[model samples]
Target: MPEQTQDDTGRDRDDDGRARNARPRDRFGRPLPFGSAGVPRIPEDLDLPPAETLDYAQRLLDEGLAFNAHEVLEAAWKNGPFAEKSLWQGLAQFAVGLTHIQRGNAKGARTLLKRASDRLSAYGTAPYGIDSPGLVDRAHTLLMALEQGKPISDTDLRARLTISH
Candidate 1:
């Protein structure tokens, strides 16, 4: 069993499977739940190689840190070749969708997922070392589940999750 944390009123919020955190975090820069005053910018001089960026993104996603993974993908979109910018944008949006799922925002998740699917669909089966078809299928499945009221387990999103090394 997972450990539960106390809310402001000292109630066990996680006990009821409340993935969405309701407590407003502190305004100070000090670390609080879901509150970051500012995040240090990534150095523009540090160029992240495409393969290394993909590797980092894959690891973050596997660890269920899709939110962080989206940052990496977004960086890739901005820094990567112009020809592949859309591909990275699609992947970033997909990661953001997964982040929405983790944050318990079903509507947001479905919206971003559908947008990602539409963007990635242009790639067909493969693009930028990713299996676009499998990703599109998974996106569709999750979107449909949200639409059909199906229970989505954390691991329900299983598909081509790795990048070619």
Candidate 2:
């Protein structure tokens, strides 16, 4: 088969002379790239150590800003060493699940939260700090409520996780 050629308008003419749109364009008529825009820019001179990543996640949880926390922790998790990667990944999933719950998407929350629990459960709450087990327990409890067609109370959830008032 011969190679087809695309014109400036992104229309390609095959050997059989059929013209087809080769690429999709954005709303402003610019051609969309194949991959994501780009990786988020990380500071080259970042001073915070890898161990502090979980601390940031905890603070996000405390402030009820799970989504942003997930973003930060996920990046750190990916770049972290293999030994502790699962732990960080689990925390990121947990935070994402809580964010879903906050947005009233119990189904989505259940999926990610279950994954988080499963991943974290294996370690038996060793490296995850003092409140780690409580957070996991609270996430599981909320997941059960979501599964059983019960409404979850914000106060109850907070108390279960021991998030101080």
Candidate 3:
């Protein structure tokens, strides 16, 4: 495959016909050269039951599809009942923080994680099947690791996060 250049502004045209500039991304929104041809997207109606909505985000998170998971959470935040908006927003911010990690933006990741932690903390733990306490704890830990110059990976994130009822 030819190397990408400044002139390669056009999307998805490669010399060897191999995939390039594909829009499909990993959980953190980083472009992946392969896989995820069929990532699940949220439906038009945001009326899914709480369990189902959380389940979808958990599945995406477990698969290292953090950005995809964020889409689900963001939709819920934007479209779900007003009372639960903060919870959903926190979840979306959490996923976005992970996306920042994927993008190798440590500062951004820390900032988002801190903000998410604060927001989710307001809802307390076990709100609508989300473990805000656990999420905030892990977010702080990850932030500490980043502060110490430790590297993070999808595998590490998967090991740390577990969405539960």
Candidate 4:
């Protein structure tokens, strides 16, 4: 076997010594071989305004790439202003809940969907015109379907992330 590089945590490290996986990932965000073609990655430092972030994440969701959408939402949560942390975090978790459904983890999907709903409920007057209550309803609907063992369709999973202006 070829020699392997070692890091303090046995994970890949970036130039700044931060744990960073350089492996490419598929549409569902599963890591692939180093040289394999993969979906374009969302930057870890992506810092878009709320509207732009929602637009980008919505496009990803429409493409049935919920995992990538989660990455974009997670970046927003990390880089957005502190006041909107819960909002972004809930959106990220919502995307992740969809991802878990796609990956066939119904239990995890249900848990995250419920948690996202709970978080979003606290933001009835969410910023950037996000339909927080709508999202919470969607999460509850999805969670119920999961609990009842109903097969979830792509159309049901890919609801608009924001309301029309």
Say which candidate scores most in lDDT: 4
Candidate 2, residues 55-75, lDDT tens digits: the string is 665665565566656766687
Instruction: Sum up the clashes in candidate 2.
Output: 0
RMSD of each: 11.2, 10.9, 7.9, 3.7
RMSD of 4: 3.7
Q: Write the per-residue lDDT of candidate 4 for residues 8-71, one digit (tens) a residue.
A: 7767776666677777998778899889999998877788888899999999999999999999
Rank by TM-score (best first): 4, 3, 1, 2
Candidate 1 residue-wise lDDT, 1-165, digit = tens: 344577677555566655433333221112244444444322323358877777777877776667667778888889888988878888888988887777778998999998889888985654447867778888999999989978887688544445445
With a 3 Å backbone cut-off (N, CA, C), the pairs that clash in candidate 1 are none
lDDT score for candidate 1 against the true structure = 0.71
Report the lDDT of model 2 for residue 83: 86
Question: Cα miss at 115, model 1 (Å)?
Answer: 1.1
In angstroms, the error of model 3 at 47 is 4.1
Clashes (candidate 4): 0
Ranking by lDDT: 4, 3, 1, 2
Q: Report residue 32 deviation for candidate 2 (angstroms).
A: 19
Using alpha carbons, what is the TM-score of model 1?
Answer: 0.69
Q: Model 1: residues >4 Å from true position, as ranges?
A: 1-46, 163-165
lDDT tens digits, residues 1-165, model 3? 355333345566445555445446544566655466645444434556677778887878888777777878887888788888888888888888888887889998899888889898887654554677788988888899899999886776762334542
- Deviation in Å, model 2, residue 25 alpha carbon: 23
Of 1 and 4, which scores higher on lDDT?
Answer: 4
Best by TM-score: 4
Error of 4 at 89 (Å): 0.2
